[model samples]
Target: MQGHGYAQPLKRPPDTAVLIFLRVLFVVIGFTCIGFASWAMMLRLAIVTRKSLDWGLFVAVLAADVLSIVLLGSEPGDEIHTAGGYFGISLLLGTLVAATAYYLAADIRHFQRLRDAYRAQQPMAMPYGYAGPASPYTATTVPSSPAAPRSPLGPHTPPPMTHTPPPQPPVPAPPQRPAPARIDQVRAELDELSDYLRKHDGHHEGNYEGGR
Candidate 1:
């Protein structure tokens, strides 16, 4: 997960206060995830938002853990069994699935945020297909920035500039980047939208740091 340095960390993580008061509930849910989701979510928060926390994966796991409670709720003769039986297995699988999803989205978000920053700073610094170090993860399949509840204008590559012969360049110069005010407006709009999509979209939680 390279390139997540730009934005300020979130101020408050989701779903901590409620869980704090419901401490007794932890004993039941604790064994369900086997601590996998908590570990994964903790890692995300620790690595991601220095200022705030991120426990999205843990929440997803908690949702799955309720299934265990449903099993315990069953009466002696009820159709629901004393043990979770086959359904109990879903708890581990659910947490693992959540962990997998969190990693994938978080990693992609990290890469794209940095990629956008890099392209903005030095649009032509590296050739498109230079074949740098291989990444186990690739954005090729995504075909675009990570999806979100609400889509925003993208960090598209800068427009191409016209080239003239080396001895005499064209009279007209290439277009300049948008003004600072324009960049700020865009980031502001993006931040606003990203707040809404923080849970669903992986890459867009922070503010833009690089400037012209």
Candidate 2:
């Protein structure tokens, strides 16, 4: 009861202080990780694809991360007093930011180009909104030739067939022979009779000796 009564209000940090701290921390961490990832990606691309542009851009991004870290860690009065330090920081950070945007934009452009290429390679029979592989089931929208009839209602209809073709003659079956006399013949006949009775569309006789 005494502790609860005497409990003091929590001393929360100022909003500006928290915001500055978070902003610096997030930017520093984000740039560092992204820069390193870009560097590794560039290395892979260079080794595999032998793309000089990617390698160059990757180096630029990495330099940016280093510049940001240095600038963030500098003493309070160092940036103002040293002209060389100020110029170097400004150039490196600015270049890093610009290069990052440029490469990202380039990547988007390349992706769109690849998508367009893929679309071109697809079969023309496929409709615009189709989601599966090209097949007869896909809706086709190609223009028809002039020889093709527009519609039955608009164009002249074909003359109705005055005479219908005669129905096909019944197929002739080979003549069957009479069953041969054998020991299994009697059993087979009994089995056939039982099958017929089971399948017959008639009321079955009750197996009772007498009916009410």
Candidate 3:
């Protein structure tokens, strides 16, 4: 006989704090530096990992870096700097701070959305009647066979049937009689006799006297 036992729960991988810290360091450096190398690395990381927040951060950082460079370049030769230069420096710092804050807010929002989606996808609890991981001690339920479908009529009643008679063949009509030609022949003979009398009436009377 097979021995009964309980199934062990599956183990999950541990979240590494060091790896996360290194990733954050790299992102911070990329944001601070204005070089193409850092930008390329950050862009690659963002794209490969499908991190929208990273992309947003890269854009914000790039904009701020470019603005700062432009502002610094606009300053006149390295004197103690004028009021305009001081204002420009302040503006550049403000831009950097604003950009960082904007991207950070975006990252937080993105994180929230991801977290919400993950929670939505996770099963809250086992389905109402679903049997979870079965244990040897758990009782197996034998589902009752569904009752056989019942007829609307009584169980012993016979189904009603309609009787239809076979169709009969149609009767044929009687043949019609042909018209007579004898009347036309008699009329023709009478016409010919009248024609002969009209042409030779005197000859006929003379021949009769001679015969008397």
Give per-residue CA lDDT, model 1, range 1-212, as digits (tens).
78868875333323445433333343334335563333444354335533233455445555665564455455455454544644654555555555555554654455456556655665356787787776767635445776644324445655456686678766997898889999999999999888868754544333333321
Which 10 successive residues of model 3 have the least lDDT summed? 9-18
Question: Where does candidate 3 stray beyond 4 Å?
Answer: 1-64, 125-212
Q: State in Å the error of residue 24, model 1.
A: 34
Worst 10 residues of 1 by lDDT: 203-212
| Candidate 3: residue 189 Cα off by (Å) | 99
Candidate 3 lDDT tens digits, 8-121:
533332234643564466447545652322444445445644777778756765665566566667787875277666655665566545544544455445455655666666
Report lDDT per candidate.
Answer: 0.52, 0.56, 0.60
Q: Residues 32-145, candidate 2, lDDT per residue (tens digit)?
A: 764333344334334433468777766766676566556545746634556545664665556545554554455445445555666666658867787885687767979976
Give the Å error, residue 52, model 3: 11
Instruction: Report how far residue 89 has shifted in candidate 2, in Å.
Output: 2.6
Question: What is candidate 2's local distance difference test score?
Answer: 0.56
Clashes in model 2: which pairs?
Answer: none
Ranking, TM-score, top scorer first: 3, 2, 1
**Clashes per model (N, Cα, C within 3 A):** 1, 0, 0
